[model samples]
Target: MTSCEVGNDPFLITADQVGKLSKETRVSQLGEIYKQDSIVNRRFDSTYIFGGNEIEIYETSGNQLLRLDPKTPGDTASRIGDIRILDPAFKTEKGLSTRSTYKEILENYTIKKIENTITDAVIFLEEIPAYITIDKKHLPTIFQLSTTHKIESSLIPDNAPIDQFWIGWE
Candidate 1:
């Protein structure tokens, strides 16, 4: 594995890695990987609902950082299927974070596609295995409500801020 740091920081995100967690990091290794941070396992409830194997990582200061979902629920050996970045401190090497805007994203990476959902426009990046969402409120009226309508990247305002950012291992 390459050195975890990007510059002087270890929290930098890349296409194949997120800080100390790489594509090969497994569910069983979370505790060891985040030993300095707080780890919370959100297991399924008694109602028999299939709540996913979501593992939350928090700073010692009580700030949430990331939510990790394993590829196979209840399987300790499963690799991370998704990583939801919750803190703004976790930024891509290109400086894209949860706080980044569409313009920043466009300037830093190539857009693969734009998917229109009822409440948001999901922007997929070509250079990175990640996607960012812009809330419907930031979109033009025509593209806000209809899921059937395909949203082009050009339609989204450049200043629209990303509502959520997620990295997919799959």
Candidate 2:
């Protein structure tokens, strides 16, 4: 087995590391890195599509753990562009996970920005270089109706739960 396949905790997440995977880990190494887990690759039929290949990691018990997008689709050597943490078991050193609330995030990390999308509010964190998204339904009616409006931290309720958590290598 290679170095990538051994001695790395699978549940720990950091700014430059997630379990056995790191910023330098390539697409080809995923199989080895996740040898104990199940990997499902969903590639687009067309080669023209960018960021179309999504790789899912699942536990033996059939619980989805993560969704990874490669920097370049179909390129075995490509590093991970981004990773979406699907399981609440996977957490950062500070104990932030999918189940963490907006208030917990505020207490733990520095907020870089809050981006308003059609259905979600994506909050960027400076320390981990990660983003946590909250569904717009959790927001106030006025904030949910406008996608162009700048979403400030104070505008979000402390009890709002995170809908998605993503770590970007870039």
Candidate 3:
């Protein structure tokens, strides 16, 4: 009878090889921005998502939300060009205006004017202003573009860096 068994090889998988394999692969996703009711009872919420290298910003107040999408979907290629938010006071060190709501922001803003125009049967934002207004309150309040909440970036991935055990295999 012929023996068809092969001996185990420990040299093929060494300690260094195992260490190299343990290195994790990671992808970044944006974070959520929100204001809790516990503090001042202000109604503000925002969720940011980054995937395939693109950034998305979703802002919510009351029952309204606005979404901003990036040009690039690849994480390494995407960058934040310009971001504007309306808040409580129209004062900042950066010299940006701040109104309480979207209506106030648009009214106080000096750069862009809100006018009606018709050309190709489509209504669009013609002149991109320095700030975009998100008016949540409409009534006795003086409508102003004010930024009360701060925007930030966060990382999101299915598995943490320490969890990705297998990747880039031939």
Candidate 4:
């Protein structure tokens, strides 16, 4: 990832810069790489119209990395007005990606488990507006890194992977 577009160090990609990334991926000659996708760049738009271009998709994960518009999630997006990252290749300073298990998150950040019955659960952080949603094992599924006070309850696609959901500024 050091030779990648974002930069040489994954730690430089802080929680604040999460949305700027292209949530989609592809298996390049070098390996799996995640670059900026136009649809993801246009996700902040309130309009639900994306003209005629086919939404860019990540090859390996098969997740729609971008959307025509978030307001109308009939296509790829689950909701509008928020950053959603489903790519496991994206990592944190400690190399904790969406693919990391719940137990791994505990090692990086000291957090108590939240009693959740649903498949999608959240780990609310006291310091940052971010809340980490994880599976039963405590692995991070999605990160609600919202500083703008967006509603937590948003639409999630039926068939989309439950591993990565980013809820923050679009």
Candidate 5:
């Protein structure tokens, strides 16, 4: 007997045993929200809104985010720098979804300058809130996007090449 019984074949593996092998791994952490004013730059600080909510980033060398608050004295008010976005919900017609998640907006993006100010950047998904532009150092410097009519769950990742969604009139 090779430690195998006739009734207990490979197919006899129970669900409870499978459950025992399952383990949980830590993915991300919750983010804290803040609202304040900036006294240094006298403008709405950009650090608050830079990193998305509750999302942890593995690498943030070329990411960018806009500040979202004011500050008091001796405070570096507005700054656009590398950020981490957690729990990013794609914009859907019914509003943002709490289910689907993405690591980064432009994970493997490529940019081509169509014109001087008008550039064509290819992103993984379409209907993104902003298109991030990277510099020679691969640091995101410019972020541009247009507003458009929200399609029902339209922001879902489509395998399509180019996105035809537009916010303003043609």
Candidate 6:
């Protein structure tokens, strides 16, 4: 329940526990614990037309694990939902992540600066009000875990960069 949290702090994922892994332990448990700059891809949605349905990425070092998305809906179709950690030695149990810089996350939270420029800084996690992001060298790249309900960061656009960081279930 807790351990599945890939990068840190209560980053839980349900949908029947990623639909019970199995595809060789979801490609060998994060590629045997981030085997230094690992990478694998099976992406699709080339603007979704039916033939565009697949989605199974698993990067390493910079940490990304969007396991599945067969049909998207409530996200049980493939499980392992969204998670993006820009490495920083991977953390989250309050240890933070994305190698934590930018003055150590502005001395630990309270950030906002939207309207383009790589969509930098917009963290908001006062206990599961999730909406994390970082780009202007702050590192921690996106953690939009299911919006945490009531999310409305201006519908998250600001010129969409930082690898298009936006996971949804709304």
Measured by lDDT, the strongest candidate is 2
Which candidate do you rate higher for lDDT, 2 or 6?
A: 2
Task: Compute each candidate's TM-score over C-alphas.
Answer: 0.91, 0.92, 0.24, 0.42, 0.18, 0.22
Give model 3 RMSD, 1 decimal.
Answer: 22.7
- Residue 27's lDDT in candidate 6: 32
Scored by CA lDDT, what does every candidate get? 0.86, 0.88, 0.22, 0.40, 0.22, 0.37
Of models 2 and 3, which has the larger lDDT?
2
User: Candidate 4's residue-wise lDDT over 1-170, tens digit each?
Assistant: 32355455532335444433322321121122344322223333347765422234354445554322233334433333344445565566666555665555555655433434355455554322235565433322443332233223222222222355343433
Model 6 clash pairs are 7-91, 8-92, 9-92, 9-93, 88-99
Better of 4 and 5 by lDDT: 4
* Cand. 4 Cα-lDDT: 0.40
> Can you write out model 3's per-residue Cα lDDT over 1-170, one digit (the tens) per residue?
01111112211111111110111111121231222211111222336633422222233443222122233333433432222222222232222232232333224333223211121111112222232222223211221233332211111111211110111111
* Residue-pair clashes, model 2: 0
Report the C-alpha lDDT of model 6 over 1-170, residue by residue, as the tens digit.
22244323323222222222322233334433344434454544444454433334444444555433333422333433344433344343444454443344345544443332333445544322234554433322342332223323444444333322222222
lDDT of 2 by residue, 1-170 (tens): 35445336677888888777788889998887678889999988765765478999998889999999999887998999999999998899999999999999999999999999999999999999799999989998877898988898998999999999999997
Tens digit per residue, CA lDDT, model 1, 9-77: 657888878877888888888787778889999987566776666889999999999999899988998
lDDT of 5 by residue, 1-170 (tens): 11132123211212111100101111110011111211112223266644232222221343222222211222333222222122222223323222322223223322221111233332223342322222112112232232132212223233223222111101
Model 2 CA deviation exceeding 4 Å by range: 1-8, 46-51
Summed over model 1, clashes come to 0
